[model samples]
Target: MKKIRIQCALLTALSFLMGLSQFIIVGILNNLSNSFHTSIDHVGVLVTLFAIVYAIMTPIINLSVGHAPLYKVLIILFSIFAIGNMLTAVANNFNILLLSRLLTALASGPSMSIAITLAAAITPPQKRSWIVSWVFSGFSIASVFGVPIGTWISDNLNWRFLFWIIFILSIILIAILYRLLPHNLRQKKGHGFLRQLAIFKNTHIILGILIPIFNFSAVYIVYTYLKPLLINKLGFSTNNVITILFLYGLCGLISNQISGHINNRKWTKTLVSFLSVQAGSLFILFLTSNFKWLSLIAILFMALTMSVQNSPVELYYMEIAEQKYPQSLVLASSFDSIFSNVGVAIGSAAGGYTVNTLGLGYLGLIGGIFSVLAISVLLILNKVYFQ
Candidate 1:
């Protein structure tokens, strides 16, 4: 029991590092723009490129290596990830930085998918959802710790310094993981590409995967421009925005755990309820932006509802795979990470349009619409599968 607990904790830490690698750029975009002697928009392209590559490459890599020993695959992926961060730390020009982010995205997507599968493989069936929640909490915890700290590092020292830190941490984690993970760990070998493609034919799986797209689209619509939202619309100082982000992240982390604790049978209802509340929160944020305290309350409340659906969604994928599509279990694990990036890309782009056309205050209104769309999808999935 203790050994399994330690293993789960290590996987959670790996999730934290991977999440940090992916999101750290958000907080330090300004510093990156300055360091590369470019506009913030150019630097912003790195985010889009990363997400596109991540979403495109994740399933491909997972399918290619689905039969390989999990232990070796993990090490190779993490080593590549570490190398990507090192390149990011050392690159002198925009092109090199762009290439480095692409490399990191290539590794990050499959790495996280395998990590979730490994967490599930090593735990009891009953505890799978709980452990999956812990793994995901790593990402929320990154928001809690990683993004703010990266922002501070960028403000105080150099932006590249943060990448260097991540690079060093990645190396140490690789060694620790090698020692802890079992040599023979592996999943059921996947079907051929054409065979595995059949998982998408099921309407339940199709709708199940779409949940994250609308869910995260709603989030990043507002979240992609959170700093301006807090400062310009809500009358917060630059420094206070950082503090508010930390609080928001803390609430998100709390929400992840709270979602994990809900009974599995209740997941369908809980997910719909959470998304509904998220819509309400964003709508409230839209209406209350002029009132400082009320807007702040709405912001935190939205954060509280943000990550509550993650574990349940992940659990749904795994359960569906185990029950009906055992051959595609590894492939199943990659969907959330893949589609969630799709959501981020969609949301960020839409948020940009909203900012340009409707103004930043309208971001909350747009996000609320996506949240309702997510709720509608969840309800449809419930009717199709759970009903």
Candidate 2:
């Protein structure tokens, strides 16, 4: 019990740093743009490229390295992540920064998926879902704590300094994880990476993956542009905008734990309900764009519900995969991570396009449309898969 607790805590802290590193760029986009002498939209493309690389690399690494010992693989991959951050910190041009992002993305996708696998492996079967939640809540914690700090640092210091911080944190975590985890942790040798692809033959499995894709797309379509919405649309000072983001992140932290604690029997219903609420919140966000106070409440609601839905959806998918296609968890996790990156990649890109063409105010309606689609998929999953 003590061993598992220490493992979860260290893994959670590592994931927190992962989340922090990924999101710091969003908070410091203005700094990057100014530093690179580029447009904000152009800087936004960095996110798209990073996600695309992550999506591309996740499966490749999983396929090739899934058979390797967990602790050793993680240490090696984490080292790559640290190196990538160092590269970014030293980058003098946009192209170099872009390349550095690709490097980090490549290592990041596999590292995260493996971390999830490690978390599941180290715990009791029934407690696995909660462990996953606790591990991933590190991401929410990044939003709650790290983003605000990074934003403040960017406002006061050089943007490159943020990557330097990520570099140091990554290196430090490697040591911490080494101390906490056993060496050479290994999984049941599944048939192979190619066999993992068979898990998708089941429509339910495929839809399970798609649920989060659409869900993330829905939230990120607007969220990717949140700073602009708060600053330009709602007439918030930068510091005030950060404050609202802090509130939003706080709500997200609350939601992350909420999903993990919900009764397992309620997983599907909770998922469907949250998707519905997300759709409604997004619609209200669109309609109430002109109403500042209403929009603020809407943001909080969206962030809270948006985050709460994620763990349930992911837990459900992993549980189903574990039961139905037990040996293909590596593959399932790989695909999950791939689609997650693809979802955010697509969402951020679409959001960028919407900002350019349709304007940020319409982002909510567009997001709501996707939210409805996700809900529709979940309803079908419940009917076809669960029932």
Per residue, candidate 1 scores C-alpha lDDT tens digits across 1-387 of 798899889889888988888888777766787888986556666777788898999998987875788878988998999999999999999999999999999999899999998899999988988899899899999999888888888888888888898899999999999999877878776668867767888788889888899988898888877766776678887678678878888998999998788656757788888888899998998897788888788878888888887888888887888888887888899889899988888887788778778888888899999999999998887777876
Best model number under lDDT: 1
Q: Which digits, one per residue and each the tens of the lDDT, describe model 2 over residues 1-387? A: 999999988888877877887877777877888899998889888888888998888877777764678888889999999999999999999999999988998888888888888888889978977888888898889999888888888888777788898899889889988888877677557777767666778887778778768877888887777877887887888888677777877888888888787647646677778778888888998999999889888878888876665556666667776887776676566565577677788788888999999887888898889888888887887787667
Total clashing pairs in model 1:
0
Query: Which residue pairs overlap in candidate 1's backbone?
Result: none
- Give residue 188's error in model 1 in angstroms: 1.2
TM-score of each predicted structure versus truth:
0.96, 0.96
Candidate 1 lDDT score relative to the true structure: 0.85
What is the Å distance of residue 258 in model 2 from its true position?
1.6
| Candidate 1 local Cα displacement, residue 204, angstroms | 0.2
- Local distance difference test scores for all models: 0.85, 0.81
